[model samples]
Target: MKETLADDLNLLSAFCGVRDLTDLSQNALYQKYQLKKADAFVLFGGSILSGIDVLITAMNNQVATNYLIVGGQGHTTNALRLKINQFYPQIPTKNASEAQMFNAILQLKTGKTADYLEEKSTNSGNNITNLLQLLETHELKKDGLILCQDATMQRRMAATCSKFAPNTTIINYASYKVKVMEKDNQLHFDRKLLGMWEMDQYITLLLGEISRLQNTPSGYGPAGKNFIAPVFIPQDVLAAFYRVAKLFPNKVRTANPAYAKSLEN
Candidate 1:
């Protein structure tokens, strides 16, 4: 039985992206910790407007007492401005950091703002590091955190959180769950959502996360760049990543030059 490309994509998406966090995903983890609510709900800044929308929904649902938006200008910063102009035209993004843009949308939608905004970190590694430092300076809760980021990077974010905030419990609530459907021999979303990514960009992100999540010597894990702690990668997930990577050649986003420099040290 020859499986279709879509089949592999489905498996990859399921393994990579997590939806809203709470009783639905990991109730047992919360029960074990006796956690009634997460100490904070943090949204990692990206081009996805839905991440901000969903994060605000979580806030309205009282998922956490503190809300933090973490990010500075990076690769996706300009793309995010495009989404802002398209979806949130009222919000000004003049020379704004990623966190600032997200905060503006959050405030416009909910009539409130984030408790803290860490606007200095430019990449995932420092996103977590700066967030921890901000938490310490503000005396914010670190017991449990519901983290929202791009769907492709959710699992990696959890691993990064575990490395930096080892004692804290993390709930990965990805901003979007990507679904690719084959039509006319091309992949497209079932329908466009706000802040939707182009198909090629989406594929690159999905494949790139697997590259980072691999436990090999060049991966982001402890054995690799040591950017994140070691986390188990299931065989099925690894297989799916390889199959899809083979199917879509050369679309994976490479690590930044900064990471290359770190590996040289």
Candidate 2:
């Protein structure tokens, strides 16, 4: 199957629709603010290496006083390890959990580490549950929370958090926003960021998320597995999804075998 320039644009539009990236600083450059720092920041480990740098920058801006890094060895573990090995050869990547890898970079770059870490979670569903359990165990309470996750999983993470912590203020600031561009009839990203997904894999991840986001039995919404809250998809997003799906009918991402074993619990 061949994809045209227009097809790629639709793919990109649909991809952006499901993603939410709030600006933590709102374009502040050494500006002062009166808002109190968030009660806590929650970082979800992922394959996107740029997230580490983004979170660090946010920390430098004094976004939060404390944070917890959450992730375990899941489908993205190998990719993260590979990125670390490729970029920072000295870092140990041997069987490193996502939180370990993220914490390693966070420490090396910023001379700091997360206040806590939830390393036993393998998927988004457990990521929230395990995070809550860890907080409760420590008796950590926060009226407001900040969520930093990979752009691909941003919405789902926030939705899951909202479901469990209905009253707490949930602020989303994704680590990266993957914007698709066009040049000479070609579809490409503006620049290559660290740990960037291959174009095909990025599209697969985006489309796969839509399937999970759809309000149906096969989705992660209340009608389905109840993994997250009900999501409303706009008409443009729906149209783009249909267009992109037509171009790549069989390209959606499948769950790793680990999901069945690890998430079942």
Candidate 3:
């Protein structure tokens, strides 16, 4: 039997939880470029330390013609640059995050491919905006833009990039592995919950859902009209309950015993 639009949407909604919707449309554009061997790469960083490792690994791969590192303010960029030099002493380096154009001259001087840096951005949105401006200034296009960031932030970064630079291609190189260490273990006296790490998993799932939703064309539609249709009312209601419960734990405990128990246990 042929499935209705609502049916199909319901199925999709079940498979993927709450999402940003824009991810769906952006993914199509990402596939069109197929930037396996591009001329340049634009890498965004969540934090200087965590972001640098991915950048170094990308540089070592020699996949793209050059690299563009988007960094935060203060000593973060400097620290990252130092780390890169220490690790890959052979690879020539320079500090040009503030430079107007692609640090083409410095890149040539190093005898390696070109590398540019945008030091002004604090988050993913600014990173894409600055990268677009840099690309325009250098007469570059979407075919060569690869996005690199921490695995946790890749989805949001990609969504921002898609909105700002629709034509520009972005390839994500961040690994999606979350490592738990013994030091992270903690005890909860009141509820017996282990640690705050569970919160991170939920955030990750939410971000992933947002990323997936943002890729769809309908995901970019008006928020008031068809932003989120309830496919699974129970799950949706439960999510809402959890959100409120988080804010008013005591009130939720007095109000709904079942919900409080579910959330607590």
Candidate 4:
């Protein structure tokens, strides 16, 4: 017998190990980490709107003094900046969509506020590449960065940053937990779909960055572009979806039957 969408969702919920949303608040984490006044918070991820929301909330709540919103080079980042400017005009902003712009933003945010070298980068690797440029431009010996992004992508970003900027302090602000659902039985499990989605965005970015990097003479070449792929699969993705569904079982169970069926199909 074929399992229903509800079944799949329920299974996913079980795999994810549901945690009470009330207990999952960021307050304790913020307090524990003592993220009172950061030089500038950098929110980088594919979930442009949610990332911006979290960054604005954190700033309003005094979690960070200023913020630099960075993301893959595409419409999302463009739309995000437009929305932010439309909503908050008092805040000074710049479009560091290019590598040079990113370097300028980094220096200004870090209190240097001086002219520096700008390099164009298009993906996570490029973000790191830009950071290296920022470090070189400002002659920074050591620095701390407040990383704000989706919880799913934080680990990979941390690992990448550690490889490139080993001396820099990384303080992560996990924004949200992503859950992936299965089609057959709604089983919830730990998976990489969410991460993969983010990784795909990063991959698209790397493609652009690879083109840019290749144009440079005697550069590292395009090999760095492959670093965006993670070592996980669909199982973890399904589990995460289930876990989130379980948190609101009634909502998952009753949510439009047609939509649920469509998911299975």
Q: Rate the local accuracy (lDDT) of all candidates.
A: 0.79, 0.74, 0.43, 0.42
lDDT of 4 by residue, 1-265 (tens): 6545444433332322222122212464346554345545566643433444455555555544444544435334454445445544443446545323333333444434222232243444555556556556656533556665444345445445665677666666555544444556433434533222343333233222222222123222224433433223246444444453444443321112221121111
Model 3 over residues 1-265: C-alpha lDDT tens digits?
A: 6533223323322333222222222343245554445567565544323344344445666556667766543222454455446544544446434222123222433434335666665434456667777777877656645675544445546656666666655565542223222223531112222111243332443333333333244342223212222222244433543453354344321111221121111
Worst 10 residues of 4 by lDDT: 256-265
Best by TM-score: 1
The TM-score that candidate 3 achieves is: 0.47
* Runs off by more than 4 Å, candidate 4: 1-31, 34-36, 72-119, 135-142, 180-265
lDDT of 1 by residue, 1-265 (tens): 7767776776777777875444423354356556667888899985377887777677767777788999887667788998899888887877888999999888888789999998877778788888898999999889989888887778788888998889998887788766778889987777677888887787788888888887789788878878888878788778878888887888878876643332112
Q: Each model's TM-score, in the order given?
A: 0.90, 0.87, 0.47, 0.44
* Model 2 Cα lDDT, one tens digit per residue, 36-122: 676777888864998887778768777776778899877778878888899989889887788988998999988899889888888
Model 4 whole-model lDDT (C-alpha atoms): 0.42
Residue 48 of model 2, lDDT score: 90
After superposing all C-alphas onto the true structure, candidate 2 shows an RMSD in angstroms of 3.7
Highest lDDT, which number? 1
Model 1 regions lying over 4 Å from their true place: 20-33, 258-265
After superposing candidate 3 on the true structure, give the runs of residues whose Cα lies further than 4 Å from its correct spot: 1-36, 74-114, 180-265
Q: Which of 2 and 3 is the better model by lDDT?
A: 2
Ranking according to lDDT, highest score first? 1, 2, 3, 4
Preferred candidate (TM-score higher): 3 or 4: 3
